[model samples]
Target: MTSFRVKSEGRFVAAGCALIALFALIGAPVIAQEANMLQAPAGMKPSGSVPESLKSDSSSATLAPADETGPRRIVPPGYGATTPSSGMPQAEEPAGPSQFFPAGKRASEPSVRMLSAVPGQDNSGIQIGTLTGVDASTAGLISEQQGGLGADMWQGASRADIDRYLSRLPVPVRSPVMNDLARRLLLTGAQPPEGASGGVSLLAIRLNRLIAAGQTQAALDLGAAAGNERSPAVAAGIARAALAQGDDRLACDALKDIPPGNDPAHDAMAAFSVKLSAYCQIAAGNTEIASLTLDLAREEGMDDALFYSLASEAAAGITLRAPEPNKLTIVDTAFYRLADRELPENAVEIVEPALLQSMLADPSVSDEMKVAAAERAAAYGLLDGRDLAAYYRKPSFTPEQMAGLLTSDIPESSSLRRAMIFQSIGMAAAADERIHLFKLAFATAESAGLYYPTVEALYPELDRMVPSDALRPLAPAAVRAFIAIGERSRAQDWLSLISSGGQMLGRDARELTGLMRVSGGSPQSFDSEKASAEIVSDLKSGVRATQLYAASEAMMLEALGFQLTPAVWDALLDARGALTGDVPPEALLNRLQASGQKNAIGETVLLSLDAIGQKGPGAVHPRASAQAVASLKAVNLESEARRLALEALMARSNAGRG
Candidate 1:
């Protein structure tokens, strides 16, 4: 009985061991698949697990009484919070050796392996540094396509050199062509020169120069266009321009817009701002603030006696007999206007041309002073000819003055003479009488060196006169004036009248025709030999003045793309003896040529203007004129070149007549 029981227990134990082995064999593949899902592949770090802070606290868990809320859903660990299974297929597991190793089986080798080095890891061709300069050169009012010198206008030049050259440019450039060129260069939107960082900016210098040259409106427009109105220097210029134009409110507002602690680069600009602040404060009825501002200015080293006197007078409503200032600025002028003080007699002489427009509008100014200011302003292109014409129409003339205008003795004062003639031409009954009056007017203006201004003033009258055989006697003068003012169509009409007369061309008519051609008139053949011989014979005969003028005309013709014989150049050289002024240096000419060759448009224009100097083209040396024309043409400024040449010819003609 004992042996049978022992056998049964042993069998049971053996069966139990066999069952455990079967269960282990069945779970081996399932464990291997789970391990494959958890392990990261070669060359990749394992993704981070859920942070401890974000894990649920099982120890703090509590059971709440149930309500009618929706059923609580169960989510698996490490799932469903961020990435839920939508209906898309899961990514296939990385093909590699399984993390688990079954007994008696070696693990397969990993299909992916780590790389030794990454591609593009070399840094030999890379530059590592910080940029150190501020570039503000791209601010301008005009573009290259809008007649500006292009974005590359200052290439091949440094900021220091460009600033120096611009500083040396003549203010109120006398020649119209040079003036136009200077204005365009200053207003162009282009890149700044190299190393332009942290100083008085180029834009500020440009704005100051424009204001000094009586181009205040242009300076204001440029500052506005550049969106730099808040800069202290630019803001100061805008305020000054506003004062010059009698817009006190605008001036005050411009000053008010400047940010605090941003002082202007110029001491004069700082002083002007101080005075303006006081004046604006007074005008706004803040008397205490105005007085305090003035006190602060004095404490801060503003020593301008004129400004203090004017401000004191305005603030206290009392007049002070202050000594006259040696120089007057737009600020001083504004204060004077505010204080109701009569401007000094020499104000017209010392005042900048920019202030002349406001001066001309002042009713208290003498008629003579107004006329002088108008002439100077017109010459500088600050005022239109029609503006002077309006001033001329203000005075009334007696019937006798009008009747004897052509035959009577010319008035000694140029203003009265111009005014008299301007009036008489309007009332003249017959065309012949008007033509005589026109010739006298032009001759009088030419003698006084006011020919261009007179031409502008009388253009409407001349435009109304029909070109006919009867008016042929006045053709040369009419055509010359028309060409001087760029009225090419009118010049052509007068030139046709000269041709229609069917007479051999006289020296005056031939020369006038050549000038017309240079001013973009209809194309015509020129007789270079005849013109040169006439000038040469005149030179030999000691008619130096007339022939010198003729020589310049011939040179101008040749420079404007008209072919002239070598004899013409020889005659021009001989005629150079009559010129007594200093000629442009050879170095300047060389620089101009070099700039043109490099296509440095702004530099070329500046050097050309410097070569021309303060005098108009007519007064410059012919060599300078020739080189300027050539350089301008080389840079594709054909229109400017032609206009410059034409001006030279017209100046010579007018000078010869004088």
Candidate 2:
């Protein structure tokens, strides 16, 4: 019985051992997964202590102290822990799963691990760098090498002074040389004047002046070069100029760049933005938005009846007979074009010369109107001479008008008369007849105070004609016209014809010689004594206007480095009695001298324009003209100074004749 019991006990122990082994095998994977959950991923640092429930209780399964300095073993739950006994074999805890799977397992799937956010950290309003101001005065489309004033142009002047001078610059500058100078000054990329706050006020003034002066293309170019399209004032100017140029797309893009709540300070500009925004929306086919914008503009107190009427008409595809405003701004003119409405008969009378430029190409206008518009535009230096010449060629004349052009009573309509003369000159078979027509054209234009425009239109035609003996009697006027347009080489050619034709001692020859000398030419028969005597006679006996003209002639000659006799200088002082109406202020002359002495190029230019005033170089006092020329010379602008002097001479001479 004892033997049987021992055997049974042994059998029972074996069964229990078998059961324990089966339970261990089943729990191994669960324990391994739990260990993985507790262990840190391959790149992450392990944190927190093993769970108390999973800690081994056996004293021999010792864990290293939490504060121990050396590397500690990470034992998984259910594993017996032991310190490393010298030379005893010990198992290393299993490493975390391999980051790179074996080749076959790589194709199983890819997994993404999302990280948790750190506590109490703020990620709002994070910026990379500090913001700073832009130097807007450095903006320009022209470089110094391309005839711009240098970048240092405004270096010595104050911002306030620059702003004042720029504001004073004449709109529709009638003198071509002054017009050119004004454009160059406005477009030059120069340093900001002293005391500038890095704002665009100075630039805005320049752009506005350019737009007001019919230099819309220049204003557009300058605004683009400035890279300040985001500024409301600049964008407004650009939009207006673009509209004036008939580029609705460009205007829309400019208006769109203006940020909300940054409208310009001027009422006109603010109104312009509000009205043009609606127009742009309509142009872009966003009719609903256009309506909303127009409504918003009205609600905001934009009181431009012309614009609203035009915009409403455009939106509804119907004509609203809007009465012409007393003063037509560029925006009004552009909208008038968009609405396809005919301008009033007195449109030219009320509109600025700058606005007249748009009508030159409008097919709806009569040819007579275009000619009249081109004449005014050309006179204001807004239209190119070649363009005016082209307009002169547009009118079709009847055979009767052509046959009686010179002989018939002059047409009542000045436009028809000028066009007939221009066409007749082109058709005349004889040189004398052509030359006579040329004289007649100039004389006809002169009678109406349109001499300069006539000169510009007919210069190219006269320039193409080769000078000869037969044309000598007519050569003096041609020479004068050539000199007026700065075609000195061509003028010299005609002067040679007069000299070779043996008319050197005639009144025309003496006058031509003096003019040529004053315009920087070296004519063959220039008699300084004879010219001086004639000038003195005019200054002594001529009317107050004629005396002023003679005095200006003497001053210009002296300015061009011609040493007129002392009597001429004394005569100029005598002629000062004739100075009436508006004269350049003494303070302005002082400031101009100061600017010149400092070599402040831009300041000198502005002050010079001011000294010349609205009526231009011809109408200003002789002292003003001479001072302007001298100041310009002081700044090393010899070419400009010479040209200014020549224009003054020509303009005064024309005024004398009139």
Candidate 3:
């Protein structure tokens, strides 16, 4: 009887174990099952010390200790719901462009927003040319027609009629528009009244006409004349005119006649004059006084956003305080905006980035104010694409603010600023977002005829981030950018990529690739004559702006890393139209040797051998100076090389010792 009982019990136990295993495999809620789910022998109690009902409730009700190792069931507030599989909620998506990826985006996407012609105003409708409605004769007629029927007719005339009658009104006229019309007319070449003595005021009007007529030199000469010499406004206007023409010396001299705090009766006019004086100071490299003059302008209530923003730029390395609201009145602010657009030379410097960032942070600043400040900063090179990216990195900003930055006025003619803004957008974007922005900046620059420096900023990141196929359209810009940044190998890499890509190359790209190939060759193999001719042709072609050609030549020369032979030097100088200058070769040499070129001192031993073959000991040839200096330094022959170079320079020039 006992043996039979044991066998039955073993079978029962085996069945119970199998049942638990089955529940585990099916992922059933067996742990939380009620007591009724299992049947116990009539006289047997549960195994756990606590009653099954109470124990089950206690396990579910009690919270886990902080350090306990188990699954955490409690989620803090706002963690809405967990995934059944993963048991953790997903992060919310960030707002803005990241949420929307435009489809079929080409490598060269177009973001054709106009750059502000004026620092803080619409570039449109602000004519630097002749006044639209009024000719010189009509202006004279308007000045002459002041008394009887004409005067009465003009008195009730609406602003539009005045505009219709006046021709090109230079600036917006405040009401009581006749005198304003009369002043503008006088300034636009209308003859002043016969008995009205042509003093400084009359000369001021004539100076304005001269400037309007594009006669900058004549206006400058007039300002220096006896009668006009004492007029601050005339001086300021002439200085402004001179600076616009790149005559910084003439501008500075003109400004000396109008000292800061030379307050005229009209505070607004005085403020305008003072701002011009500051620009002259900047052009003359008189940054200290420029800063002081800007301060005085603000103190006298010159709160034009352009003035302050530019003042901040000129005062780089100094912390500038923004003007009070009342000081920057709408009318005055509008005038400054007009001045910035009308006279870009006046505020050519960029506002400091840190100060601009502070302005962006201030809640009191209007979107328009921020936009104007940012645009001016960028146009003048105070801000860049990296700065733009920083602006976007913030957690919150209005769509209007983003739009304002993206569409801020850069001139269609300014490739540098356009390229810069485009690159800045790329710099601030995530890796996934960069490709489109980079291509857009490059494409826009090319479309607008701007071959720009900002391309250099995009080159190093191109290989990994940009696909091989998208590179063809970017070839010219890439070559130029790489060369400028002194990345000769990378520029070669671009050429290699394009050559191997099985795509047809553009003419400009082909030329650039050929140039790079020549540069990469041995010094003896370089065709200096042909290269110089090509450089001249490129300059004349104006594919890139003329001013940039010199820089390109400089880069090419540096990239070759060869000691320039006299023949080569002659060719380059001839191309530059600088061969006949009395300027010492030392100056040119100094410029070439400075940071960007980084020529490896041509093999020092080779230079010595050449010198030995050409000249006696210690007689370093003028053409060999570059290699001599670099090689000497490389082989610890620096002092001897220096001596040899100085001797050559002295032999080459009649320049007296400093």
Best by TM-score: 2
User: What is the per-residue lDDT of model 1 for residues 5-104, given as tens digits with 9 covering 90 to 100?
Assistant: 0011111111111001122222344342343211222232212232222222434221100122332211000111111112222222222222111111
The whole-model lDDT of each prediction reads: 0.60, 0.61, 0.35
> Candidate 2 — which residues are off by over 4 angstroms?
1-135, 197-200, 256-266, 285-302, 317-322, 345-358, 361-366, 406-413, 447-453, 460-472, 487-507, 521-534, 579-581, 654-658
Provide the global lDDT of candidate 1 against the true structure. 0.60
Each candidate: RMSD to true structure?
Answer: 35.3, 33.0, 38.2
Give residue 546's error in model 3 in angstroms. 9.4
How well is each residue in 573-620 modelled by candidate 3, as lDDT tens digits? Answer: 444442121222332233223211232121122223232222222233
TM-score of 1: 0.69
The lowest-lDDT stretch of 10 consecutive residues in candidate 2 is: 1-10
Candidate ranking under lDDT, highest first, comes to 2, 1, 3
Of 1 and 2, which scores higher on lDDT?
2
Candidate 3 — what's its lDDT?
Answer: 0.35
Arrange candidates by TM-score, descending: 2, 1, 3
